[model samples]
Target: MAAILAAGAGLHPARNAAAAPMPRVAAAGWAGAQTLLALGVVPLALPEIARYRALVAEPPLPESVQELGLRSEPNLELLTALAPHLIVADAGSVTSPLARIAPVATFAPLRPGRRPAEAAREATLALAARLGRDAEAQSLIAAHEARLAGAAERLSGDRGGPLCLVSDAFGNRALVFGGNSLYQDVLDRVGLRNAFTGATSAWGHATVGLDQLAALDPTTRLVLLTSRVPDARTFLALRPLWRTLPFLREERVTVLADILFYGGLPSADRFARLLAERLAPGNAARG
Candidate 1:
């Protein structure tokens, strides 16, 4: 049985004689939830599960975990009610508020120059250690790596294919993702070249008009990360530059479901698999 201790916040949940290693966890961020799920632990509570579903569908959240409200300003009363052993949250304003409820451990989102995939692996391992789920973490990491390697092997020949990843945020504008992003890491792992080699914000994206995308080689394959907001269909339809794009004209465009580009290994694996299935040779008839 783990001894009771007043570790900083308040009372750490005391372990029973036969208690499970991490009986109950409540993650205040989606990445934390994803990592916990990757370790085979269904969190007791999740932050914005419905919204998370729309963005990152894979490694789905089980119905059992309660919703903790908005990611930015989580409901403190609800979080306190969950009585989590640890609250895994993003490092930001949310942390201070959540810490009042339970022991808070934070993971930095979009750290500059850190490959999201690598950061995810480290975060998973670190979280696993904290929860005494090291073995599960190893298995999850191995599986993630295997999936990435398989995708890489299948798309090996597509290395030279100039690629551009865009998030359709507005009708006439897009956020170009590249440079130290998990998507870029996944792209490199899957042997695709990112055509947006210019500077990017710390989050690894640059908001540009649709016309700016055409600056890349005409043969470049454009992939859009889609979401509900700024509807991809409506945006593409309204944007004149989208119609004039060579890739769009030649049918070389691929649209991938919106994923948590900053999520843990599972998200990276999911991204890689999507790219491989859509862009791999013989997978799709490309012009």
Candidate 2:
């Protein structure tokens, strides 16, 4: 069903309202927005949608979407003005106020130990049922699986050495996803093994000092860094000491797309495809 942009042009209604109830959706976070979009539902308004402008560069968003934010808080007045039937939000901080605005449905990040793809698949299916588009949800999952399979075939036998996924910076301090993270899920699908295979927490964000990283196995093949900070070159330049690390010495550092790494969703597929292009056989070897 085509989305209906309200007369104000800010609120987009679902054209399939008769077949599926046209509920106005408010996405509190980018991941939620992505999940909803993948389900063929466009939110009426989103507060943090603008935060993801850079993300669309590699994956691109549909032109029919619009965003509405009333500052840090979703404008309850604006939400009421749009007269939405449902609101989808993250289970984190913004839930209370968002629920006050309307009947809000909350979703959490994929927990540790759970398969990332399975969690994402289940969430998409549940969301589709909520939107009355179960068939569309199944189709999306199939397409995602097909894309992943194609990527896997293309990168077969080109698996790089064990890699570490890090976020944040300075080398003095960093956050790494050990074994149980959505990032790990992507790594697993792409046939890459994580270097730090210790016990991971339920949600999996382990902050450690650079000294710990320096002590890691010298054979570590590559490091994938994800951060909110822009100017990856500048970030790397600031960490001159990091160059002394074995991985860096071997010229095995790759800065990943922040959105695909941090944001929830199988959007990691985009990053996986990019990795395949860079690491596949016949590609230039690291310095």
Candidate 3:
């Protein structure tokens, strides 16, 4: 299946063409950078470098990768100065300015109605082909499949815990992920049940009030998702009620990596594996 997808996607020919000589590449989003890294190709410029701190943790950025600016809006002058051979941006940023700077390729990490893991795989395979690393891309897909299979096997026995995947940044307002979102994908893969699986927006952010959350009640486990927001101390200080909630009291509140849920590449499988390990019955006690 992967071979057919790879061949149909034309990854091999594209990768071979790219490998004739190394080309300077600029990545404009977190997911694009991840795809480049997965292909064993480092971007000359990355706009959102800071958000990757939690993602990259202990390992330092390779010298080949340069910080350009925030992903929301990059420094055009700096990007122009880098003289990138190829500019990779998201669908939102594939503007004339970016195109004028260099040959721009727009890839979306999460398209409305598309599954996150499928998007990740497509993005990785596409980038690998474009960068001349088809073999590496194929290997990545295989590894992802194996990891996902293992996670599924480990989580197969779960009888479906009541789950709430929330993007809890502000105090009162929260966005719940459901429907076709990555959060839904992760929860499904881990054998957990989402309490809110009704209608969801294409962006995967559904604004819900505290009253709505409280109504979901004690039995439902809550997963808080944040991207390096307020310092941990400040966040804890502000949301004391969160810790006092019945779900938290029962130790059902789990904090997951926001980047993996939002800006993941083909590595969404890794996030599933981690969740399976963390949420699997008795596995937490064993650890």
Candidate with better lDDT, 1 vs 2: 1
Clashing residue pair totals per candidate (backbone < 3 A): 0, 1, 2
Which residue pairs clash in candidate 2?
A: 24-85
What tens digits encode model 2's per-residue C-alpha lDDT throughout 167-241? 666547777777777767777786777787766666555877777777777767654545444433455578876
* Displacement of the residue 2 alpha carbon in candidate 2, Å: 28
- The global Cα lDDT (0 to 1) of model 1 is 0.73
Q: What's each prediction's TM-score?
A: 0.87, 0.82, 0.81
C-alpha RMSD in Å of predicted model 3 compared with the true structure: 4.8
In TM-score terms, candidate 3 sits at 0.81
RMSD of 2: 5.8
lDDT of 1 by residue, 1-287 (tens): 01111143432233331355554678888877887888888888887889888887778988998988788878789878777768888644356677777787675535655667766767776666667677888999889889989998988766445888887646667789877777888877777788888778877788887667777886798777776434334545766567777777766677777888777687788889888887777775432
Ranking by lDDT: 1, 3, 2
- The TM-score between candidate 2 and the true structure equals 0.82
Off by over 4 Å in 3: 1-19, 55-60, 157-160, 227-237, 240-245, 264-267, 285-287
- lDDT top scorer: 1
- When summed lDDT is taken over every stretch of 10 residues in candidate 1, the lowest stretch is 1-10
